[model samples]
Target: MARPGVPAPPPEPPRVGITLQQLRQSQGLSLDELSRKAGVSKSMLSQIERNQANPTVAVVWRLATALGVGVGELLGDGRPAPPAIVTVPAHGTPTLKSPDGKCELRILGPIDLAGEFEWYELTVQPGGALESEAHEPGSREHLSVLAGTLEVSAGSDTSRLKAGETARYAVDLPHAIRNTGKTIASALLVVLHAA
Candidate 1:
């Protein structure tokens, strides 16, 4: 709150559309090309560029992946240098949830390294599962249980894990981390993509 006679802070400028357009133009990419690469419709891209549409988080993630840039870079000025020490507030971290709403994943890795390597703090309610399809060939994941008990399945193999236990498994095939315990479960999950 501002004191009497004190001015309030200025509002932040809208930058998403501008930044998207600039990145597209700077990369010499046409609307059709970007749409194809980002797996977004050209019409939607045009709307986004014209500030007529506000994209969802999934759309932004796809755009960032196609541009080979971080989500922050797409949302802010390009690739700003980090300070000696950087702190991202807990609330500022991005999160993804399962469609069933029983599992939540807090993204913990820098977006720039998303495809190569990524980490997440995962929480699953009792009887919930974090299931995933095959990843890129040779991709692997490591899960270190932090609370409660969980079960991990990679292809045909499965193992139960308790707090303080870790499991490393290939994720190129179908995989899942299920919380079959009576309480919530937490784990640190790290994924390493193929070369």
Candidate 2:
């Protein structure tokens, strides 16, 4: 709704646009190949490559992983030279939410290390659960509670951790991080994939 003399604001442009075509071409991957590898539709991949459509962070993550490149590279931020320090503002970091919307995972690790080694700040609202399917064989996770309490279940085993406590367990089987407390629970999670 608009006021008597007020006009509606213009629609915002898509957030993601980068050198996707160049990266795909350099890797000798056709749209179909990349689509299959990234689990994206061919049309969507084409649109993204042509900068005709914007992809969500999850899509960007998948594409970067499929291309074996960093998210920064996909975003056209090439690291031609090593810098002494690189800082990313908090607001610039990507975050993923669980389907139920009660759990949030702030991606803290670089996309380039996604499959091999990754970390995230996990936040779960009371009574929320971050259920996860089995990861790669021999995969493991280390979680250190930062606030409140969290219950972790790996396979048939379960453990509870409070602030300042850590738990390490295999992620090769189905697992879950649950906040049974009345308050939100946060933890620093690190994942390591087998070579």
Candidate 3:
């Protein structure tokens, strides 16, 4: 059913491509103003929009609130489609070996979360580690140990996450992931950001 002057609906946006940037710009906001209003770091918001990083739910909430939108607005209805999960291809296995020989993170789907953050699967070699330097503000993160054991260190606090165990924290926590058990370890990571 096409209207007289209206064209057919264009293809749907991939899950992550719908970022807050589009939403904010639609409302006529500048990055600096949005950062100040949302209380998130300007750099971080830029990263999220560029799909340069993943953000957490909490950070999503902040941006949404500041924008007068709902968290669902960020994740969207999964609609135009629906809540869907995408996996990486075998040939796409990441060549990003860990410098610490500890762990490697392979992004599973579109890092953009379309309005949210990117999600990934982290594979940690026994005694492996995941590290990253400080990033922009308004970024949130979550982790779930799917198989094996994972030791997560955030600042001065440490948490041992076991199989089927899950945890969520602020990306500002300055954390790292390590595998202490025998055998390879894997987990799911969801990152939300202002971008």
- Top-lDDT structure, candidate number: 1
Candidate 3 lDDT over 1-195, as tens digits, reads 889999999965434325577678767899999999999899988887786766677888888889777677677743323224445577775445687756667766563453367777799988788876544576767899999998887667788999999987666657788888898889998877656
Better by lDDT, candidate 2 or 1: 1
lDDT, model 2: 0.87
Candidate 2: misplaced stretches above 4 Å?
Answer: 1-80
TM-score, structure 2 vs. true: 0.59
TM-score of 1: 0.59
Give lDDT tens digits, candidate 1, residues 35-142. 999999999999988888878889999998997778887777533334345689999999999999999999999999999999999999998999999999999999
- Candidate 1, residue 122: how far the Cα is off, in Å: 0.4
Q: In terms of TM-score, how similar is model 3 to the real structure?
A: 0.50
Better of 2 and 3 by lDDT: 2
Listed in order, each prediction's TM-score against the native is 0.59, 0.59, 0.50
Models, CA RMSD each: 19.8, 19.5, 20.3
Residue-level lDDT of model 2, residues 93-179, one tens digit each, is: 999999999999999999999899999999999999999999999999999999999999999999999999999999999999999
Model 1 residue pairs with clashes: none
